[model samples]
Target chain A: MSRWGRRPQLSFPDVGSIEGPLLEVVDLHTSFRTGRGLVRAVDGVSFNLARGHTLGVVGESGSGKTVLSRSIMGLVPGTNVERSGTVRLSGHDITAMSLDELREVWGMQIALVFQDPMTALNPVVRIGRQITESLRLRAGLDRKAAYETSVALLKSVGIPAPEQRLRNYPHELSGGMRQRVMIAIALACGPKLLLADEPTTGLDVTVQAQILDLLAAQQRERHMGMILVTHDLGVVANRTDDIVVMYAGRVVEQAPTAELFARTRMPYTEALLRSIPRLAEASHTRLRAIPGRPPDLATELKGCRFAPRCPYAQDHCRKEEPPLRAAGQGHLFRCWYPVGSAEGDAALAYNVAARVPAALAFTGIPVRDAALVAPNAVGSA
Target chain B: MLRFIATRLVQLVVICFLISVFAFLLVHLLPGDPTLAILGPNDTPAARAVLLHQLGLNKGLVSQYGTWIMNIFHGNLGASFLTKQTVTNALGVAVPIDLELVVVSQVLALLVAIPMALIAALRPNRLFDRIATTSTFAMLSLPTFVAGPLLVLVFAVTLKWVPATGFDRLSQGLGQNLKSVILPSVALAIGSVTVYYRLLRADLIATLQEDFVTMARSKGLSTRYILMRHVMRPSSFSLLAGAGISIGTLFTGAFVVEVLFQLPGIGYQLVQAIYSRDYLVVQGMALVAAVAFVVVNFGVDFLLTILDPRVRRA
Candidate 1:
């Protein structure tokens, strides 16, 4: 009989010998077959999340952060997309599992909090039904029991008038309330790992913090692994135990969150930190926007994907790609000359002196303004 | 909700009145003299005038319209000039047959359309989808008259499973009545099935891509469960609206099918009355059909508001 036939036994078996990481992703690659060419949405990425730890995935749009999360969850949309990787959740290699087998993992072992609360819910369904759905499906709870549990879950998510809210539709609730309901539903089955992809993207600034805090508190309470994917560095700064910064479908840098901020090695990571709009800055300060567009995934590139926009790119940087290497204890980055190293500084000075127009053209700043920004950037590096 | 329904009901009344007036004028404004047709074209002018005055046709158009409207309020639909039978009684005998045909055809169309559309939507661009699409297209291209005869030839003549070109009332044995309607219903339903299949397939495809469907999958709901609960309901809203308008068309198509099959339906009665210049019967049937269309559309609106909270809030 399948696992869902009986009441779930909470006692986990000791699968001996292969006592691996709680969640292990090895060299995951997800590519899509577009009309023009193959677009590598996620290429050669890997990470581990121990139980009770939060892994923050930081990247801009099209950085494959969303696809990486989906790939891990086995939720990638179409057969046209090719994926090769091993996603071992508590020793089972889920990468090769069919969709039917994946059902046992989803909700019971893993759950996801989608990005848009507005569209992430069935508009016609009541909030109570949405929350109770997983409870009934995964836990085999009866309708009344599931509904009561849903009410409790709503209360746990800090929703007021939980009973009333349960009867209301998604559109009847405010954005914050709907997001809280989404969280409630994600937690309904007591998942071992929760993948929250930009859980606060479209919400108001004030509500974003509340939702993030709620997720963090729930994670701590349940002691579940979490992968928080976001484009904003500030969101994961204090929330995540570790951070992985991706660029052009590959991880550019990975390190402990504090270490990543304090002694960042990748130029892209350093540039990202510099671009954050600090509240301490003087009023009306111009935010330093990143230069150039993200690399076109449809095209093949010869070298480091960021070289064209990197201020420290040498000729060799354009000819050869740099592999991810350890720069410091528990720190890994893909860069020929690590940021803050003497070689990196010298390369930046050489590129500046060479008057490389292509490298500077991406900044959209005049030469004089770039010259002014260069010293401060180099000093930070 | 009550207020909305009340307002719609008022509008329904106005619509029915307008339809009555249009039907009355259309019969009256025909090039041939209705009075002459009734009295015989060879009759003397004095005789024609006497017949016209006796029949109240000598009254002005406004007075005639007023009298017709007042009689409608009193449940009188005037009298057929040919048989002198009350139009209401003629309709009473015919309306049930048309209603049964329309209802049965619609039900049959939905039964075939929804599942096929859903299957086509499930794995779009696949073999099942392609076959369903092609077949529906072929079905759509075949008009009712052609399909009706073809059904007769296959089921009535070849297989001899059902009687050819006739209808049995439900007051008869249920099985016999169903057997009689099977061919006609299937023939009448082909076009609707094609339309509904296409509309629902498109909508279901779009609905399946919605984030809610992904969310349902994330909850570990079975594919069948997700399709039935999450995808089907929302996708069906458009199908329901389309079905509402198609009800009107179905009635029109039923006229051809009923006449072809020699069924004693409103369509048959209306066609026969028109050929024989039975103006009262034509007017009554036209008004009834128009009223049904309006009422059905109103019901669709009410159902939509119930199904979609957005429409309700609006």
Candidate 2:
């Protein structure tokens, strides 16, 4: 044991998955029973992350990224939550563990760094007291030892005058320092899996870059699996090894960092990439804006969740919900007819043909010849 | 902190001045005249008018108020109309007895209330919590007057263990006086403790949900240690606020308890003064009560700032 006390060392289960990834989530479906009905926040979402790898979960607001992280930590509040599916960490099934069992694994096997460090830390308490509270409880450390360890934790996160800063309240620290303190707190027990929920959302762009670099360095040093949830594609594009694109509570696409950018099958993933303004590109061209808002969760969707927004959606896409089929060796997409390249006559024809059959099946809107119609209004004409 | 104190002091002065004016007007506007009440019904009209003038009733309302406030701003609190002695001197002797009673009652109430709250929180849906809830509800419904006689019947009339009425000061070698104060303090505290337990238990339960407490549990701290070191300290902030409000309202409740126990407090003196229609004494006692309220509120505010850093920063 360490100097503080005898803390049980967490054992990684041998599930004969050395050839595979360290963590695997299989068909995870989490729902909350509201007054209206079961709000399926996450439906059949799956991904895996190996040791020393960064998995970026990119989605719009209310797309279930935060809930997914909280589920992994077993920290979902409210009585209406109903979780299902297997979440295997080091080959152990963590989905069925009780809260007491989860407590033993928390901070030592898995830790969470939440968004908004200011709200996460208590305002009425000193930094030292808040940090040492866990140590004193779990490690059987007395006050003096806990205080010393707290100062050490502060220094590890690169805060200057760590000893004095421990005595200061959270309000006394800046946004960046507070986030660093959060990271320090998460890393206190040296966990293997670190789930960070938009860890640098409210900070300046420069500070955001610095914090991401810090987390990257820590993950590499500890050989830990990190899941970074963010909306900024630029932030994760260069940092993450793999990317899982979520749309309307389902995994729409999954690919390696380079492959996902080079070859995206799902129209939503392509739209997200196209929406980002490239400073290196020609300045005269306008930034592409994704048409329509996200799907309302209160409504029950019948087909593919992104079919209403996808430019290349076909009749089958509207009649049947598309599952994640293999687009390549590692790339996956939920669209029946996936589109990868930029806009062309063939791409336009493909989009028009896809919508015409679906519209015919639903509203009986006859398909018009593109050659006879007006050039500006292809779908309407 | 200094600015807060300065503002409170200004407020205290303004409140005391307004109270004096209201008390003076109330006494003067009543049907009975203080001179006749003190002099009896057979007194001559000429004698009453002469006495009224000497007491400064011939002056305008504004002039009388200004003089009363001026006397109060100095060391003087005016003279009692019936006793014809300095009000400060009379209060100097009576105030300590009231203080003794209030302190003892509040201490006893807190002692019982804290344990009840702890038991209630610890056993939440179990028998202990149910019993505490039932007993507190029963105590809350019972008024001090009813409880006083019931205690008298059980302890004094039936058991014959102690005297049922009156009080003796601590100066009498601390035996009979201390013993005499116990029954009254217990009777007063029973009602107050019921209210206190309800507040404290709610606070304790609320504190149990905080993130720091969750972190403490993850650290593998014992449940008792977490409750004592983390949960209790933060929860006390709310309890301190409730305690402050209770002390502020204590004087209002003190009137009923004092009358039941036959204690010589300012509340009793005010009641006797009102019955006799001694206008000057009533006005003097009202001003003192107003000042006491402002001082007590100010003290509670400071205590809150000391106990809670959020309040201090705010």
Q: Per-residue CA lDDT of candidate 1, range A1-381, in tens? A: 223333333433432233556799999999999887999999999888888899999988989999999899889876588999899988788898777778878888889999999999999988888888778777889889998899889999999999899889999899999999999999998888999999999899999999999999999999889999999999999999999999999999999999999998888887778789889989887777677768999999789988877877777777889999986777899998778899887876666655554335424345565555533223222
Residue A173 Cα positional deviation in candidate 1, in Å, after optimal superposition: 0.9
Best by TM-score: 1
Compared with the true structure, model 1 gives a TM-score of: 0.94
Of the true interface contacts, each candidate retains a share of: 0.62, 0.23
TM-score for chain A as predicted in candidate 1: 0.91
> What DockQ does every candidate get?
0.61, 0.30
lDDT of 1 by residue, B45-159 (tens): 9998888888788899889889887988899998899888999998887777777788889999999999999899988999999999999999999998899999999989999
Most DockQ-accurate candidate? 1
The CA lDDT of each predicted structure is 0.85, 0.75
User: Which window of 10 residues has the lowest lDDT sum in candidate 1 chain B?
Assistant: B247-256
* Cα RMSD (angstroms) for every candidate in the order listed: 3.4, 6.0
Interface RMSD of 2: 3.9
Docking class of 1: medium
